[model samples]
Target: MHLPSRPRVATRPVQLAPRPPQLVGRDETVAELRERLLGSDVRPAVVAVHGLGGVGKTSLTLEYAYRLQQEYDLVWQLPAAEPAVLSAAFARLAALMGLRELGADAADPVDQVHAALAARTDPWLLIFDNVPEAEALLPFLPPVGPGHVLVTSRSGRWPRDQGLELPVLDLVSAARLLLSSSGQDDEVAAADVVSELGALPLALEQAAAYMSETGLALSEYLDLLHHQRAELLAQGQAWGYRERVASTWQFAFERLARTSPQAIALLRLLSCYAHEAIPSHLLLSPLERWAPRELFRADVQRRRAYGRIPGPPARLLRDVHPSVLVMMRALPRDTLRINAALTALRRHSLIGPPVDGAVTVHRLVQAVTLDQLSRRVQRRWREVAAVLVEAVLPDDPGQKARWPRYARLLPHIRTVLGPTSPGMDKTARYLGASGDYRTARSLFQEIAAALAAALGPEEGATLTARHELALWTGEAGDPTAARDQYVALLPVYERVLGPRHPHTLTTRHNLAQWTGRAGDPVAARDQYAALIPIRRWVSGPEHPDTLTTQANLAQWTGQAGDAAAARDQYATLLPVRERVLGAGHPATVTTREQLAHWTARARP
Candidate 1:
């Protein structure tokens, strides 16, 4: 008898990152995301689900992805907590798709992943989980063609058209989550628990876990929740918030502190920033970090030397301002060490996934961490953040090219320095430079008033702010008002900064510019002709300001009905404009066009 050969069965690996168990009350969310992924729109689409941390953003997104698992050929989850982590995830994906050649070196895995994604004929889904900021997620996002991208974040700042906010669950669903495995037959009892936990799924899950682990019933859990809320909430280990949502993560924090003290220390510093996106380079950027340590240790040692000393038996401690400096010099600068700490933090979810090039901590988490710090330590943390942000701030807010960098630090600037802080002047200047004249004008006016009061009339920062306010005020459409301000400011500039000083010259230039803009072309032309000599002498004939003044003079000369003079003036300036600013420079090009137009008009 001939035995039949065994049939061959081909097996292929299917990729799907395991999602959390027991999703409740997110059927609508899952359905909505699914529809978006499978929509008729052929263009690439991104759907971001956002809300407070621990509101089940990740769970909701994961559940949605799982439901549509069969509809796509590929499914991948990437951590968005840091740029490196995101890159690593992409590198892994690239390798999986046999694009390892692009991933092997220190190349950006995103490009390879993008190419692979574009090449795929099948539909796919990529979830950027725990994004810290919208900016951070952009680099890793593949070109939206054949694949659907879903982002889970705590930031509601994602583009409005593509984002869905996840709110806390309703009573019935919240109660159901708690009751699902409680074996508790009473829906009313579960509702009570849900109500006590504020109908938050994360909190409910923690409550359920605590009950299950400790063999407590719903009534018993309710008793603990009321009487020993903090202690009960601290019982379970999890990654998420540390307050409101705190109960669910207290254990994880304690464990993190034990397993990675550096992680806890990093969190302590991070807790000082706004409870939103925090730039990673602010920590790992190789700044002169030990300065903060030296300052801290000196303060601490001084306090130790005199702040508290042994006294009479009745009073064991005495307070004094101890007058000596002690140095710890303990702030770490090693990139590897900092990275290790960040890794530990991510493992514990103390910090969210990175967006752009930074990470974020939940507001509640920040609250909890700050609550744990001594007031003195908290102050030091704030001081450290201030120094770093101030250093990174763009040098000149007047340059449009610097606005993007300035904008990145704006939130941190507001956090480190109050609304009335002198730092806001520069921020406002940058705002104006970026074309937000309305906001710039308002901020400048407010800051100028406050500064004038605080620093008195003659302070430099105050006058500078006032000058900016007036400039933006003009840009926002009141040249006459701006001209008046410049007239008033000129005397002060001359008195304080002296004749020919840059500030004095700037005020003069502004005065003349607005004089013409206010409909006095004749006066402007005469003023510019006079100003051009002074500008040429002070800043050189080839200087930008000198050329600018000459151009203005030429324009107003034409506007004043001297077309022949304007034509001759422009022709004379054309060679200088080309020599100094290049032949194709916009100003040079405009000058040539002006000369040609004037010559054509004068030909008749």
Candidate 2:
């Protein structure tokens, strides 16, 4: 009897692009890929790798294929960015598999290829590169059998547990890539280059390629990167990449512009901010709601008047430019629209997946996006960003409940409005409130100097900055320095703001507090005593500030060595504090504690 012969399976050539000439810093990922695809008990193990454009998804997939190709009887890579192109590639793949006759006989060549792979017992590997949608490849994927499937995409819509998101290269690997690709020996310059490029592998490679071709030193290349960013980013083509670094992102931007104009607008707005985590709540909230009315008034005032736009000028409302009016009216107010825009950007990997209610765009993405904008457009968005940030700040920065919000918005405020912005003073106060008094003091110092230089030493803004600097100095463990600073500032405050100004009175109060802190309790007591009647007269007897002054006077009097007087003073003030500030108020609680302590001391 004769046995039936099995059908002969042809050996097909692996069609992977050349392996990245050198794979740097992906040992762990490569290992994980091996375990996911080869170690699985499930047949035809499937995995998808996704990440930002230019983050090395393709390079990583290629490396994995090249490293382990020998384990498969057949390996093929197909570009899946477009349906028509992918379909044609499938036809070519059919021809390669010697399934041309079978495909020609069938209505769909892709279907024939899928069936052939399904029936085969020989191990196979198929890679789909640049897939824009996971469902687009449903028809092209071979069924479960003796094969494995790998996919790379910028989209993150792959099935859970089957997708791996690739991040940019680590700093060390990024520097090594730059040094090796450029054939340069400057480790320091290489490090700087990688940092500027956001440790993105494609950017590092393109930068290296440009340096290698031009023979420019790393430092020179870095200078060009800063001064001629758009030109430099558009210049170089890496060996294996069809598009330069800028083009890689430009394609995504163009796609977004076509599919979701709102997403493009959001990305431009984000470009105006520092490359830090942007809380999603900021975008979803109505722009008018986050941007206080005063911010627009200030903006319009600056545009109309030639000099410093001081305090909120209600008069500026009528003088507002038509353009400013349009911008205000155009402020984004639709939460659904904003959420959809965020989804669109995330779909293209233009922004990272939202973590803890915030998202981050890569620094390079920010730079390239800004470079593409007209100067006028850039300025408009920046103004919008600043206004939004300023509006979100709490009315009371020193409130413990509001400190977390301050922490979240501080980096954005500093970047959008600069260190000298009036909002920054609140941020400094927040830092001191949160107990980073040293940073608070240092930041206030910078603000004071900048304000003095820009607005003159005697400007109201400058005096306020100086006042904050002194207050934080006392809080930051330098009571003597704070005392001396207040001493210098009080006369200036009196001269410029007048002795009766609220600012002048506040300065007096801080001076007294710091003097007590600096070890002169008697002087502090006397100063408070003098300020009490004036505060009471200026701010009403039961006003919070007047009550604060009285409370401070009692504490300092006790410190000046009259415990009985302090006990009686607190006894008198405690009911007033409880009545005005509420029985549960922090000040009321403290007054009760102080009364009990001074009462006990009086007994001795």
Q: Which number leads on lDDT?
A: 2
Model 2, CA-based lDDT: 0.81
Candidate 2 residue lDDT tens string, 390-420: 6667768789999888888777877887666
Worst lDDT 10-window in candidate 1: 320-329
The Cα RMSD of model 2 versus the native structure comes to 6.0
Query: lDDT scores for all predictions?
Result: 0.70, 0.81
Total residue pair clashes for candidate 2:
0
lDDT of 1 at 133: 71
**What is the C-alpha lDDT profile of model 1 across 14-37, one tens digit per residue?**
344455677888898788887876
lDDT of 1: 0.70
Colliding pairs, model 1: 80-353, 80-354, 81-353, 81-354, 82-354, 136-355, 136-356, 242-246, 243-246
Tell me the deviation in Å of residue 395 in model 2.
1.5
